[model samples]
Target: MGKYDLLAKDIIKKVGGKDNILSLVHCVTRLRFQLKDESLADDEALKQTEGIITVMRSSGQYQVVIGNHVPQVFADVCRIANISSEKEGGQKKMSFREKSLDLISGIMMPAIGILCACGMLKGLNSILSYLGLYSNEDGIYILLNAIGDSIFYFFPVVIGYNTAKKIEMNPFLGLIIGAALCYPTINGVDVPLFGHVINATYTSTLLPVILIVAIAKPLEKFFNRVIPDMVKTFITPMLVLLISVPLGYVVIGPLANMLSNGISQAVLSVYKISPIAAGFLVGGFWQVMIVFGVHIVLVVLCITNIISGTPDPILAFTTFVTFTTTGMVLAMWLKTKDKSLKQIALPAWISGFFGVTEPAIYGILLPRMKHFVISCLCGAVAGAATAALGLKYHTMAGMGLFEIPALLDPAQPGVSLVRAVIAAGISLVIGFVVSFITFKDEEPSQTKGEEIVSEKCKKEVIASPLSGKVKPLSQINDSAFSNETLGKGIAVTPSEGKVTAPFNGTVMMLFPTKHAIGFMSDQGCEVIIHIGMDTVRLDGKYFEAHVKEGDKVKKGDLLITFDIDAIEKEGYSLDTPVIVTNTNDYMDIIAMMESGSTVHCGDDLITIL
Candidate 1:
């Protein structure tokens, strides 16, 4: 009877049922499903489901878009379906590119937020030190610095744990191996092991720990299968730790370091060729890289550059992109006459100032193709200008206006800050001017203060789609329905299984499990008829669809059939909700059938104006 119980059941059924699901996990806003057969999933049905936003198939994950409420839905899904959330064995094969992207994203995504916060904190501390408000010797300063540095200092342990989980190995054993690499006694000391001298420290390094954990996966698996269960727990971890740590320091660590160093040098060489060209490339294409989830590579490179020596100029050169996006959104907000567009653009503009450009990019600019291109061009110009001025950051941190603190150098007074301000000014001016001049509103405008009231309000009545006892949608157990998020409507406790069309219209969405159907009335009202709460857990056992998406139907035409008694016996409520999904387009929606009254198919159930 939880709020998301019915939704969870519906999702499980639409995703090829519980048997098709091998493993499931959720991150931020997506439900990542690893299915036994990906093709068996009802992609369209899940996309049309009420709570779901969209569906994505990326990096071998059948991702269900659930917005911010994914965690709640994910929990309900696990409980209702009785499936483990852990990474399962015997995963389906994926392409090399897909596997690489998945591994990198898996390890970096979880830590990026914290890393950015730490970087911002360090930037703030530098600002304070420059202002004479707090010296480096101050307790507050030391504590703050330590807080910022902890993640990087113990970077190996963090990367080791995540990489181990990504590769399906023992995470604790990975942690032990990571810890061994950073242990003061072992670090910087040459140890003769297996005719090799191992003398490497893994303190802020990235590639070495990842390589070590990747190599440990098969070794751990070998030990698990061979060792007896009674001694497997201790022996498996011990062997993994003893072997991976020494080999990592002696071979894997050194080799990975060499590769990382080589790549870092190549990037530096590119920058040295013409800093202006390098800046233009990174600045212009950075957001594009972000869309494809490849921007993390740049972040890795910057971190490696900093670890090797000085902070790279790549981050510094690209700082103007966020500001450029913000400027474009501001221009759109000011130029657009549409109320809705202005509403979205205003908040997106504010977010851009703080270095979060996703809203501005996805919501405001990208939609207007020309505006997005203009912003990127402006970013490139600004980047070229910054490069010409030779501005560089000593540390990586948040971008946009917030990045100014990071750009400040204590050794030189006001030089980098002045250059940063000039770059931001150029980016803002170009973005605002170009977007304001080129972008045009294609949507038809509504006149203000010219309300045309019809002398007689026209009413359209929707016939009942189900034979049931009437109930208001407010009384439903689910808030998504009860609160009228989808739209205002009514519910019914079905006395039978057959669902007929309430009006003549095209079928918009028909769930593969036959539990729900969405219809657009010929009169233009969009509605969804959802049958039997939580009955989707039955996995199409008692329900059948008479029509598919895009089928046209007349009033009272059979659309779906189900076994009412069979569903009720499974402890699910047969209270079906018929909702007006496009309620905003109408002035009002009023229920016509009396609560608790018996209603048959084609009976007037609700009236819309």
Candidate 2:
């Protein structure tokens, strides 16, 4: 295989060896994978792997950030994994909330590669200045700082481009809106909207541009519909440009700023009440805010305070969150047996230490959500301790480990420095110990086809609830069961009216309608025995519940008896689907009997391993 081809092979292996993948697609800087089970993919491993740029789980996609060569990598992934380039069964429609998340990630993620590079550059510059290797006045420092600040300064323009694509609006129009927001003449301009004076500062902001583009989509649509076909293209864009820029500044920009200001006041209030509690909250949820792209304004606020010689203590707490993230990754590195996970965890840990936590946050912690919570609690503890010890930053500085040096106060006589170190140690130890004790490697990916379950993995045998002929779930008439949206299992055309316990389980629920019975198998399976499709409409007619919910039942014991003839005559197909509701919990569930095979009560129906 070629270099890119080999890289794709490695990518597939790290993402649970291709079998776990449901579909794949690509955007500007990402290989978005829709996986069968997200937990099976080793995101951290993929992040540390060559040819991959950090990982992100947003909008129900396991996004592997690949750079400008993403299309080539995508082709390689498709070829290597033997999957189609186009996503199968078009991605499920997203909810408004999900669409919002998709918009934010799509916009923000495209810029993340440069953002990481810039952050690292800035951090490196900070390191050099602290070490006396470079001064802020040096040409090298000035040039490097400018390069590092490029994306942040022009962030609004980039966000506009992304928003346009998301909402299917004209791209350049979105770019113009963003450029107008960032224009030095327009930046920080004050305007009145809805009888209120508002500061329209759009530079390096997210909400204003996003809201502007969102409004522009419909406006573009309106112009496209009304404008004559002859000069429609130019006329629509001209009219949109004319209206959107002014509307953005007057309405969207100011409104976004007001909301941002309200949030800033709330954050400040929390700190004003109790610095310790504020520190704890900041340390714990700071990364979360960064994830949602909500930290830009707060960062601006803190930087403004620092520039005006006002101390901003709250942000200093966030530095410890990085340490805690580092600690958790270190624990994963030490504890995990998976060589791939161990490899990525170590690098992720190091990255987190340097205040570059995207590696740890996206690649590791977020996948294992519980470990993320542990990391947050550890950070909270460290933050509270840091505040109690009176550690605060008097100067604006780089993030992560670089912020430690800036936390020292000349007035505190070196004690603050010691406390900074102490707080870091506390966060590290807590994160490490807690994560190490609780951390477990992901359940190993199963072998191809029939799952080769481990010895300890007990198999659950579900007997046929009612005997007749077996049918593939997809062949069933009802979309809910046939589509497997409810769960995976086989449907049976019952020859008899009675339903029996498929396994040694309790009647978890006996629906009032008596159409379906939910069972909790002693083997920990949640099986639902629906007697007939849409038989619930019968409203207990021609259906009799033999056992009430919570009643224990042995195998072959009757649970429900329905008049099958009456139900069929009533236009309901008695295609009883014995569904394993918690299908995700097991490795693989397979039918013991072949489709169309005749079966009786106590016949082996499904086997879950």
Candidate 3:
């Protein structure tokens, strides 16, 4: 067995076993599962599991975050579960939004690495030319540019193959279909088909091939069902190609091309209205949109703009988000006294600098409320500057610093390169400086020696963190808390929005959403005080934290304050879960109060033994 076998098995069991998974796939760092019932998966157990970093339910998939080692872990997961690594049938019905996310994520995820590599190559080529190390006519320049441009030139084939596999069709057929569209003989040849002149090339096109392959699956199935087994193999493909290829050229291709053009024009029109506003809106909300999986919509827009031979300002504007996120992580690394947190933040910053911000967002920024806001605000300023200066990328590039190369305009090379560098510098400086200044380090009330002594002692009782009516953990709507996966806990429906320290303890973690806080009691009990159900969506709008991680506090000290009416109006439940994260370390955890009984802050709510 492999090293991750046990961890894989544990993950499978915790995700409601193999039966609950309809399809499974892994991207660079996440194990994306299309589960039978999303709610059945043990989110808390998976999060607390040894190998997993976290759990995210987004893009119509339950994503198990495993960081860089996910590919190997994914292999072990597939091996142990006896499941196919490739896309499979039996996808449960999904909403339109979910379906769109799944499709876009599937198509785009596989290409990101190569996209980054090519983008970097292109950028390096431009740098050499600008420095007079190599001219555009040089053999090295031609070879490198060809290498970088090959993917975009044949983008339809790549997209078609991936989209075909996602829709469970013959990927080879999809490739053939894409090739047919781009074939020299067919392209630019105005053939009179059904009174329409079919004279379009498919190279670098986005929508047509995907639409063609999507329709081809049902057609392929139809042909297979009617054709005899003896000749089905050849005949089915032949029929599919004959019908799909011509129909694609005559109708599907044209319609999709028009749609792509329309979308591109619409985005350009909007950007022209107020470039700064567009930049600010995109840069500020880009990360937030990513959290909700809505950012995939912009992927289509970017591709459409690139295919239409227009520079993609939408992508250009949003590039600041990664740098800003990186800045925040770096600031956290510098400001934090916790060695372990610094270790995590360092790598997350590096990842963000290279264009991948998931680590920084989830590992560092999301956990630090002020740092995240600072990053977003800085990103917005940089994005506005980038747009105002008319910065754009001719092709889709890897985000963050890696995308600098993509910003070089082949036609106006030096000017665009200079603009890109300026924008990037602005983004990096502002993101780092703003975050460094605004994000404060935690100040513990007790000395290190005192904290160590407190850790050695055992606390007999746990007090309520909020003045509210008490309820059983099982009664909470959230499965993670209700299942007691983190530990034995109690819930409170708060009448007041203030959360106080239930015991004299050091804060372990304070989530960036300002909705959750983790505390390690001086008496050695670890607790998590989550403010509300799904309040992470609010993005700290109605929430405020008074303490930072590592801060020590006394019982009844104000930890956080929130607006009850505001949060409720925003559609968030006020049922707070006060959990003992280290439940296994204790013999028993008993609730002192009954359900529906009102309790005051610092009142004995739980007893530990």
Candidate 4:
């Protein structure tokens, strides 16, 4: 193996090798692994491995947080391990928390830093103003405001660049749209559309930037369709540039701005009438939106509010969810049976300290359905309190550990440091107390008689990897993940538990993070069994595998089993997804009539049509 291979191999072995991982993803500098269980990962060994920088367990992801050179390392891992991007059957259904983390991990990581910086700066400004140290008319104050405000003002450009990179669009085109939004000519232009000329400012607006990129995606596809192969790559981009830049200004840009303004107005109206109500709504649903990338839409509103010199009320309330999740993390840390979980809970708590809730929620807290309620109550209470107090955060930084002098001010009066702290503390107390009191330490199980199924699935069913509630593919909110591309699928309803394979196959590859598994069937179909939304960071310690590489078995074979009690103790999800990758080759896929049913081994699930 080359250096990359050696590095990948070393990490893989430490993470439980080929059989332990379920799935994998990467950011600019990190390899995010979804492991079958958390025990399989050897954090100390991984740290000692060559070519790694650091490891972080955050946002329910066991992130081998490598720096800038991570993509190459990830690619090497995939290549040597024969990891496939496509699954064997349909995609598995995932919970809202699991799905939300996936959306935020990539582009949002960078954006978060900026948000934090801006928040810190805004907080400092608030304090300075409160102390009467400087007036808003001061040049230094204005310059500082511009400095912190630039990222939010040109958010479209930043989002556009990231989105283009993520979907393989031209980064330059994204820049063009971003620049256009920042352009003074375009900013002041009033285009008569419908009954009025658009009076929109592109600065600090979210919708125009995202909308332009959204429009550019289809346009890029359209251009690709028309452009010939010989000059395709270059020509397609060029053509898209010419067409999209103008349309972004004339059509998509204006439309998106209008839509964002409308949303902003709606939010304001809600806040004005009842700040507490608005806070409750935002606090409750912010995480839900993250599940499907819908939160990105609200970002437009956030930017709009910020640009108008009023920070977003929704953004302030959103922290309630994180704080609540943090409390759950604390509770879980005190509750699990597995040793691996005890180790993870510490880091998750650290992340929670800095207000990075994904690791806690996806890694340690949200897996248990009952425990999740504790966090929800905490969120609701925190949100209600924050709103009732009319507490506002002027900066965009994260809460918990990331809390800094720049992000807090007690004198602003509407929303101040004392209020934010009180709300957050109350939320933590509620979540921790509820979780500590209510969470059952026992491993989840169903009575033998309780495992009843519909008559149709008697012979053709696949038992769920974990027991919980089952939901339909259509109900899953991620656009990037759908039934059509995920192949034939089933989602397990699990508050928490062990996950095992339903059929026999060669374990293709496993991730170091221990959040997922991948296998190849006898018929050459690829399969992926992902545990939870983003529990890749657990590193497989909580998972116990029954088989290893080259193992051959029939249906109901124990490929892997999980420690639900351990997972819950760590504050993570046990919602499992079993998906087949080659569904496109099949004529039809049939699901058994077992809605709201419990299943067991050797059961029939679907017939290939």
lDDT of 3 by residue, 195-305 (tens): 766778778888999999988999999998999999988999899999998888888998998888887888889999999999998898888876665676886688667
Better of 2 and 4 by TM-score: 2
Model 3: lDDT of residue 443: 63
Clash statistics: count for each candidate: 0, 1, 1, 76
Compute each candidate's TM-score over C-alphas: 0.66, 0.59, 0.72, 0.54
- Clashing residue pairs, backbone N/CA/C < 3 A, model 3: 123-405
TM-score of 4: 0.54
Model 2 residue 308 distance off true place after TM-score fit, in angstroms? 13
Which run of 10 residues does model 4 get worst, by summed lDDT?
Answer: 85-94
Write the residue-wise lDDT of candidate 4 on 1-609 in tens digits.
Answer: 555888887776666565556666675346777654544465655664645645655455566855445667877888776785311221223457655565445445446556767766766666677668888889877887777777877776777776565455666777777776787765766867556576557776665666677678888888888888899888887777777766677677768867867877887888899788777877776656543334555554565676555656766677656667777778878887767777867777766666555555545555555665556666777778777766655556645644533325434533466666677787788777777777656554565334432221233334355555666555544321232334567666565455566565577756544566677655555566777654665656787676665667566666666777777778875555566555554555566635566654445554543
TM-score of 2: 0.59
Q: 1-609 in candidate 1: lDDT tens per residue?
A: 667999998888777667667667765456777775454455666766777756767776787867546668988998888765544645655679867766776776556556666777877777777778988999999999898777777778888887887677778877777777778877778877777777776787889999898889998999999999999999988898888877788889989988988888888899999999989988888878655545667777777775554667887777888888888889889988989899878877886787767667766676678777878888888788778878766665655677776666646536767777888888888888888888778855445213322311356789999887999878887555665655789998988889999999999987656787889877677788878665555657789888989999999999998888878888889889898876766789999988899999989999989
Error of 1 at 322 (Å): 1.3
Question: Which candidate do you rate higher for TM-score, 3 or 4?
Answer: 3
- Model 2, span 1-609: residue lDDT tens: 555887888777766556557667665446777664443355546666876757766666777766556778888888877776543433433467655555555555455545546655655566566567877889998998788666667777888987786566787888988898888865665556578665656775667788888888898999899989999889998888788888888877778867756655676687889989888887777768756534444555564343334566777777688787888889889888999888778778876776767667767887788887787788888788878877766554455666675665534525666787888888888888888889888886567323433331578899998989999889987555676655689999989889889989788877677887888887678888777765655667998888998899999998888887878888988888888877767888999988899989998999988
Ranking by TM-score: 3, 1, 2, 4
Superposing all C-alpha atoms, what RMSD in Å does each candidate have to the true structure? 8.5, 9.4, 10.8, 15.4
The deviation in Å at residue 16 for candidate 1 is 8.4
